[model samples]
Target: MSDRRSEESSGDEPSSSSISDEVWEQFLQDTERDIRKSAPKEPSARAREVTERLKGRKGEPEGWRTGPAWQEMNGRAARRRRAWAVIGVPLAIAVAVVAMRPSLIPGDPFGSTAGTDTATTPLPAETATPTAAPSAAAPGTPTLARPFAGSPALRWADGAAGIVLPKATALGAIPKDRVELALQQTRKLLVDANLNPDVVAGGRPRAALSVLDPKQPDVLDNLETSLRSPSKTHDPLFLFSRFDPKDVKQAGKVVKVRGRITFAKGKFGGVAVHADYTFVYPVVRAGGSTEVTRTIVRRVIDAELPDPTRYQVTPGRLTLLRYDEDAGNSACDIHDGYLHPQFPSQAPTGSAAPSGPSIDPYDRSRDIGKQEACGTVSRT
Candidate 1:
C-alpha cells in the first residue's frame, strides 16, 4: 500500500507542477502585452525605459468611460476649446489690424501733401489794361475852372471889376455927367425912399432904396431897433449898401474917392455912402467978403458899384463890407467902399478937424484895431 500510494502522489505532483508552470507563463505574457501597450513608442530610449519600468503598475485614476456621461463631458470640453480658439484668434487679428492701421492712413488734414518742395506759391499779376489820360487846358488863357474866378472868394461877378456904378458908363472913366446923375439919384432916393432908375441900373438898386426916410420917425425907429437887435438884421437893401462895392470891382476899374460912409464894429451896423458934394461944387462969394456957401449938397453917391457876389447884403439895405486892409499892404484906401468906424466924418463940424489913424480897407493883419479886426471877417 505504501508503494502504490507513493506512485499516485508522484503522478499528482507532476500534474500539479505542470499546471503551475502554465499559469506562470500566461501571467508573464499578459504582463509583457500590457507593458508594450502602455509605454510610449516615440519616447527616447531612456524615456521609454523609464516608462517601461513603471508600466503594468496600477495606472493613474481615469474616470472617463465609454458611456453617455463621458461623451457629454468630452463634448463640453471640445466646445470650450473651440470657443477659446475662436475668441483668441479674433483678438489677435484685431490687435494686428489696430497696430498697423494708422500707418496705412492717407492725406493730412492740416498740412500739405508729402513729396512737395516749396512752402509758398506766388500770386498772379493783374491783367487789366490802363485808361487814357485827360486833355490839358490851353496856354495863356485863364481857366475859369479855378476855385476862384479871379478873386480869392467865390464872387458873383468874376471880380470887383464887374461891379457898376449908378448911371455910370459901362467901363468908361467916371465923367461929370455920370457923377451928377448919381448925385441926383442919391438925392431922389433920400427924399422919396425910392430906388431911382440910376440906382436900379446898378446891381443892387433895392439896397439903396431900402434906406429909411429921415422924415418918417417910425421907419427910423425900426431901423434903429434892427441895428440894436442881437439877431442879424437881414434887410437886403441895407446889407447891399453896407457891402463895399469897391471890393467887388477891385479886379475891374480902380477908382479912388474922397468920401465917407457910416460903419459899425461888429456885425449889424447900418452904413450908408455919404459924400460932401460941396467939395466939388463951385463956391460963390456973396455980399462982399461975407462968404455965403452956395453949394449943392448931396448924400454919398453909389459910384462904380461892386459885383453883388463880393458883398453880403440884407433886405433892409444892411451891407456887410469887406475891408481886408492888412491883406492890401496896410493901405487904408476904401477899395471896396468899406468905411472904417474909427475914421472921422468928412462933414464940416464946429470943432477942429479930428485927427486919428487912417483906416485900412484891406487890413486883414491881426494887429489892426479891435473895430477893424472885427469888421474884416471873411464871408467865405
Candidate 2:
C-alpha cells in the first residue's frame, strides 16, 4: 500500500506543476495586456507607473513580453517627455519675457513722473529779460515836466499853465516896430480928426484898432453915422478922441476909458477892427449925492465898407463900448443902452421902433418925464 501510494503521488505532482506553469504564463499575458492598455500615448506619470510595473515582472518569458518592444515603448516615452520638458521650459520663459516687455517702454511708468524732467531743467542762458512798461497817469492831471519850459514869452492863465500868446512879449517874442507904428498912426488919427488920409497907406495894417470907451452917446452916434453914411460929414481922425464935448457939457468929464479889441481878416484883405466903448457920466441926486453912472456905447469899425443889405448891423454885432460899474447889469442893457437917445419919443408916441430892453434908470426918467422918453417896455 505504501509503495502504490508513493507512485500515485509522484504522478499527480507533474500534473500539478504543469498547471502552475500554465497559470503563471496566463498571469504574465494578462499583465502584459494591462501594461499595453495603461501605458500613456504621451509621457505622463501613468506611463512611468506602467513601465515600473512591467520591469518588476522580470520572471515572465523574456522574448514574449519583456524584450525589445517593451524597451522601445519606454525609450519613446522618455524621448517624448524630454521634448515636452524642453518646449515647456522655453514657453514659460517666453511668457515671462512678453509680460515684462511693457515696463521697458519710453515714457514714465507712474503718471506723476511725467513732465518732472522738463520742470526740473534750467532755462537757456541766451534768453532775453522781459522789460516793464510805463504806467499811465490819471485824466486832468498835469505832466511832471513841461514840454515848452524853455520858452520865455509864453504865459499860462485861467485853468492852464504854459499857455502861449504871440502878442504878449513875456510869453513870446513880438515885433515892437509894428506895434509902435500902429499906436502912432492911431494917435495921429485921433488928434488930427481927418478921415481923408488912410491909416495904413502902403502895406495892410497888421493889427486892428478898437475904441474901448467914448465919453458921450453922441460921439458913438456920430461915429456910426459917419461910418455908415456914403458922404463923410466929419473927419475920421475925430474917432480917436478919448473924450467928447457933449459928455463934458452934460456931465463932469472923465480921463481914461477901458475896453476890449478883437481882430479878424477884413473883406478888403486888411485887419478888421471891432470897437466897443462905455461912457461914464457924473450925476447929482437929491441932497447933493454925487454918483458916477456908466452906459454902453458900441461901434464896429471895419477897414472896408460893408453892404447894408449883406452885412446889416444887427443888435447882436454891437457889444458894450464902456465899462459897467455894476457887474450885475443886464447883458442887454450893457449891449443896447446906447440906442436910448436916438429914439427920444418912442414910448410916448408909441412908435414901432426897433429897440432893446430898457434900463431901470431910463424907465424911471421916462415915467417922471425928466429925460426924453427913449424905449418901450420889453415884450419878451
Candidate 3:
C-alpha cells in the first residue's frame, strides 16, 4: 500500500505542473495579440514623402493668387443671392399656388382683339369701321322729362336745326340759288314727315305729301296708300316717323336729330339731295306709365328737283328717288302706320319675333343696307 501511494502522488504533481505552464503560456499569447491590435500603425511611405515635400515648399506671397478680387467675388455672390431672391420667390409662390388651386390661371390671357401673324382678310364696307363704343362715363337714369339720358342721342342737336344743309354749289346746269331752294324745300319735307308733331302723332302727312310731285311714279299714290292701309309691303313708317297715340305719347318736346344733307347731279338733269338722318324720340306709355323709352328712327332718302325748263316736272315740287329706313326698339313685324316701341319690361308680342341678326342702334357708323327680315336691336 505504501509503494502504490507514492506512485499516485508523483503522477498528480507532474500533471498539475504541465496544466499551469500551458495556462500561463496561453494568457501571455492573448495579451501580446491584443496589444499588437490596439497599438497605432506607422505612416505609409508615400504619406511620409508628401509630408516632407510640403514642409520644404516655400509659401506664396501676400497677393500671388490669379483671380477676381475678394470684393468682386463677394459682389458676384451678393448678385447671385439677389437674383435667386428675385426669381426664386415668385417661382416658389407660383408653385405653391398651383399646388393649392390650379383654376385661378386664365385659360386665354389675350382676348379676341389679339391678332396672329397671318395676313388680314378684307371685311365688308359696313363692317370695315368698328362700332363706336358708348360713353364710358355713367349717365343718369332716364326720366319722363329727360328721356334722352343714358342715350347716345343726348349729344345730338334738337329738331330741324340738326339737319345741317351743305354749302350750295352749282351742279351741271342747276344754279346755286336753285340748289338752295331745293335744299330748303327738302328740309321742310323732312321736318313735316318726321319732326312735325301732327304727323308723328299718326295724323295725315298733308304738308309732306303736298311737296311730292304727283307726276312721279308710285310717289304720292304709294305714300297715300301706305298711310291709308299699311302692310308689310307698304309701310309709311319708311318716310314718316309715326307712333301709336293710344299706346304711347311724346315724353318730351325735344326731338334729337343728326344728319348731313349733300347735293349732287340728279338723274333727270336736276339737283339731287341725299339726306341721311337719325332721329331720337322719347315716348312714354299713353296709359299713364311714367317710365320713358326712346325710339330711334334712321332715314336715308334721295330726293331730286327736276329742271322745269327741260322736263315736264311740276314747279316747286321734289321727286322721290330712293329711300331706306330702319327703326330701333320697335316691334319687328307689325306694319301699322305707327311705331311699336318695346319697353324695358315688355317682351315682344307674338308678331314681333326678329328674323335677322341683332344690330346695335347706337352704331351710326354703318349704312342700313337691304335687310329682308325683321331684326333685333342690341339696345334701345
| Top TM-score model | 3
- Candidate 2 Cα outliers beyond 4 Å, as residue runs: 1-180, 183-250, 264-269, 283-295, 304-356, 359-380
Off by over 4 Å in 3: 1-137
Looking at model 3, how many pairs of residues clash? 0
Candidate 1 TM-score over all chains jointly: 0.16
lDDT, candidate 3, 186-245, per-residue tens: 898899999999889999988888888875545576677878998655577767889889
lDDT of 1 by residue, 48-104 (tens): 000000001124212212111011111110100000000122222222222323222
Better of 2 and 3 by TM-score: 3
Pitting candidate 1 against candidate 3, the one with the higher TM-score is 3
TM-score for each predicted model, relative to the true structure: 0.16, 0.23, 0.64
Model 1 off-target regions past 4 Å? 1-160, 166-213, 232-380
Best by lDDT: 3
Estimate the TM-score for candidate 2: 0.23
For model 2 the local lDDT of residue 155 reads 17
After aligning candidate 2 to the native by TM-score, how far in Å is the CA of 221 from where it should be?
16
lDDT of 1 at 147: 24
